[model samples]
Target chain A: MSAPLLSVKDLRVVFSVGGTLSRLRGHVTAIEGVAGVSFDIAKGETFALVGESGSGKTTLARTLNGLQKVASGSIHFDGKDATSMGRAEMKELRRRAPMMFQDPVGSLSPRLDVRALLAEPFRIHGMSDRDLDAEVRRLLTLVGLPVDFASRYPHQLSGGQARRVGVARAVALDPQLIIADEPTAGLDVSVQGEVLNLLNDLRDRLGLSMLIITHNLHVVRQIADRTAVMYLGRFVEMGETEAIFRSPAHPYTAALLSANPEPDPDRVHDRIKLPPEVPSVMARPSGCEFHTRCPFAQDLCRRNAPPLRVNGGHQLTCHFPMNTPAQAGLEQAQ
Target chain B: MSSIRGSRGAEMTMTTDQNTPAPALDIDALSVSFATDGGTLHALKDVSFSVPKGRITGIVGESGCGKSTLINAILGLLADNGEVTGGAIRLGESADITKLTPRQMRDLRGLQISTVFQDPMGALNPVLSVGKQMRDIQYRSNLSKREKDARSVEMLRQVRIPDPEKRLTQYPHEFSGGMKQRVAIAMALMMRPQLLIADEPTTALDATLEVATIELLKELQQEIGCAVLFISHHLGVIAELCDDMIVMYAGEVVEQGSVRQIFRNPSHPYTRALLDCDPARLHERVKHLPTIPGTLPDLRNRPKGCVFQARCALAKPECGQPVTSVEVTPGHIARCIRTNEVTA
Candidate 1:
């Protein structure tokens, strides 16, 4: 009911390819990394961006965090426009919305101990006047790490422990939003459960909104309130997580869901095996970006780009969506 | 060789069936220790399993579970400081791999036992063409150049790589991740090895490619009739691709059974915990996922009792004593003192 915590509208990030020679010759090529994406995250809501590598999920996250410059459109965070924010405002925005990178150990300074890593955020945000020691201990305890871990360096901690430390640093500023990229990656199954539980617990306890970018659909299914399936830097499907899993509107969403290997051996897995190659962003397919890989693709799909069709909260960009009889019936009525 | 005979005799007595053909690879009471700076780290202890002929046996475990060590021991490529402390790795009919010299092991590696690693780029030569690399893998064979080339093409075709002849000329960089992995698999099966060791071969690929690769592996294994040892940390992949699975915990095989049996009813506390931890197994959204409580025991000074005792929820004071495996059912076993209580 309240205003959304983060609102991104028509966000686009582009990068110029080739060297200065191509620019001098007036033949420079540009690639759209995050091509005109839009989404909103309500307060305390967990939103997930699911796609394979180079699908611009990470780029979009970076753009929101102000790590990457947006070519167009706006990022409104906590009732403030982040795109046009000056240095001080951007610095404040960074404090309120911290980014947790993929590699836990690599992201943390190897030289710094857990205490310093936790304190660094407060110091950067000009909040070092408070008791840093107590704050460090509090963060460690919050993330379910032992208080003794404060003295340990990044290399000393295991993968799961390092990830917890990363979590502690992300929440150090008491941020309203936490953008985690592949939060459970490279962890063992049991450890992954621990990390997920911690994140879930933190979300509930702190009342924080989250934007999770991951290729692991299992994570999305478990944690996300809502999800968006990105293909070639744009969302092919966006809707309630349960609805998306139950009956995917876009063919790409169905393919992704079926492709995830379920742990049960008894369940027959009829995987939608797409053609191996992912089309380059520079040379995206005409019309539907996923038409090349979509098993149900037809002549009409390749001729024109599909509009974002909305039915209730579910949205899809496909010429012929799958597994939504109600939406099909509605379209027929229209 | 004579010293390993007693263990082989013991293994034979344990086998329930006499008519079944000899397993492609039999690892009997195998123990591997690495001389680390801290101490002699026992990476694998009393690890016993059989890769049955023409069947897929998966080894599933997290990091430090010694799956890699077992593979290295089988391939005779353990690090210089690592040693086979005890027991035997009997490959096919005659050889106890631990006793084999470097020369003998090299001769047996490619022809008798081939391996497909996780990263295809690392497995393949970046400078050389795919055709050249595939052809060169058969250097031990007496086949002619043209014959090897033809065999390479056939192998690629079997893996369903489009336009095998044209794709062969392209280098590793030219192929996509899935295609490169396919190429790696084709090359590994080129010799029709008695046993194939795939160490997390599909972990690097996307979800679609991962399932596709799993299906291809299943089809190819059936076609080649070679025993496969599929090692992965993913429970889902192991469940889907393997016929039999060995669940390792802290360098010890905690449970071993048919995939169907294990998935349906896991006997060991560790196995049950691991299965519960998998997000794919959980249908409903829960507030907190079940997690194994503690970290793996230090390898240098492993606990006297069960390796997973500290983390196991069903552990008892009696579990402080060293435990041997208990047969839950025919062909299903768990190495835990509380197996009876838990299974009951």
Candidate 2:
């Protein structure tokens, strides 16, 4: 088999947080944003990092696109050591790996019209203005936005239009891989569908690898080929999308799948409710971060962190991994 | 909490009559408009829906579809420039809410009806502790400090906020997003109001947290026996938690029916389109999602006939005429001229 396009090993990102007052109190806390995480993404594949807020999914995406600093561990991107890349190499890497932001309203330049926003990438890459206009129009059409909308400012566009502009900007440089952070986050379902379709189309046509970071399971089901479920800066389950949805080996993954609300009223779901709140990342648990909320957490789970183990093409980090009752029932029926 | 409601017994009786089976809320051709500088924006156009006693009624629409305007009109909380041009909001058999003065409405607010907004921080005070805010809501009540504190703690526990006593002493900032929503839910239910208006209460939380919050809302609604008017843009949420649903488009209700009937046999083209667009409903992979072709018609330039005709796929030339709502099934109504031909 061909090597993966991106490989990350034992990645860690730590930050020191404190002010002068905290210094007087002798308390400077370190926040481990991404703690010893590892993953690989093959070319022309859609890999999703699914997690809620404070789960460090965003941090991991930022690291992938060179926007975030890596405190430790190694990253091999397109056969290059990303962590040790110098200034020129970093710039080149950035050109090949573009990022789509979560908030299109904030990401798109308010002062500039859509034409300029989309054309700026080409200008930055030293393309002449003659080619820029054509490229801008092409990108806009690619994302299904009208050519006339190219003259509209960011504020003038609707939520769905602004998101299309975000996608248009991300793909302007014709990058190999796109990192979209909650691309359809605040959009309505119809609009979200449009964006997802655009993403799926672009991935297939351009033969681009994508790293989609979101908390939405529906999006994961619709677009992702493989997925990694993250919780508090660590991957709890990683495998094929269908397999994870069918039989989530980790308790957190099962709980998350159950929590997803289906649109069909006939298919009434009984969700597995987690205990009150996800604990603060600053004071993470001593062993497995999820042990405090895991329904099947045992003493061994609370005392020692479980290592990721491979089983049936699934990588799960749970001491006693088992399929949920729903999955088990389906298996029994089969 | 009981004492607080007891103190406002007169106001409660005034709003809710002793009629045996009166719906919690009823609106008859309610119309709301805002006097903008350009022209009068018809925020809500002859909207009508009822919240049955002890049942959950959901209103689903896009952001500018006037779902919020309908909720605002119910609470008499529209903006200064906005006005109710026509129609009546009947609260049970006793009160026509449109006729109530601001003072009377204020008196009836927490006693008879309360709201839980999407952003809990906007509803809560950052400087005040959770307990302080709860006490502030009951300032008009005759309860003592100790009783108020105990009641607040009890309400917190009722929402399943772990360490309820410790949580009350903390400020809103100390609570997580999910926890803040729980606190907000707890505060809304503290008054034991007959009607609970939850406007996108779980939109800000994650999917997992959203499920938990909705479960809590359902549990609390059943326990309090309050008629809940849940307004959300998420169809999945409406399907899961709502008993009945109202589909809105351009300030008008395009469809209203039992949740089961609407999902299983939708008659409106818009509702059918919405159901088709849902990612969860798709099992096969398609390159492009089937999109409803056109954008929502501007409220100011709303079409003369069917508001949804501009974007509807099955629209005909006769759609330009006034569309009449037809009862496709028992208790299932759709505001479309071709309801006979269309099927889910």
Candidate maximizing DockQ: 2
Q: What is the TM-score of chain A in candidate 2?
A: 0.93
Clashes of each: 0, 0
Clashing pairs in 2: none
Q: TM-score for the first chain of model 1?
A: 0.95
Task: Write one digit per residue (lDDT tens) for candidate 1, span B52-126.
Answer: 888899998888899999999999999999999998888889668899899999999888899999998899999
Q: In model 2 chain B, where is the ten-residue run with the lowest total lDDT?
A: B1-10
The parts of candidate 2 lying over 4 Å away from their true place are A19-28, A123-130, A268-270, A324-327, A330-334, B1-20
Task: Assign candidate 1 its CAPRI class.
Answer: medium
Q: Give Cα distance to truth, residue B221, candidate 2, Å.
A: 1.1
Q: What are the clashing pairs of model 1?
A: none
Considering every candidate listed, which one attains the maximal TM-score?
1
Measured with C-alpha atoms, the lDDT of residue B281 in candidate 1 is: 77
Model 1 DockQ vs. reference: 0.55
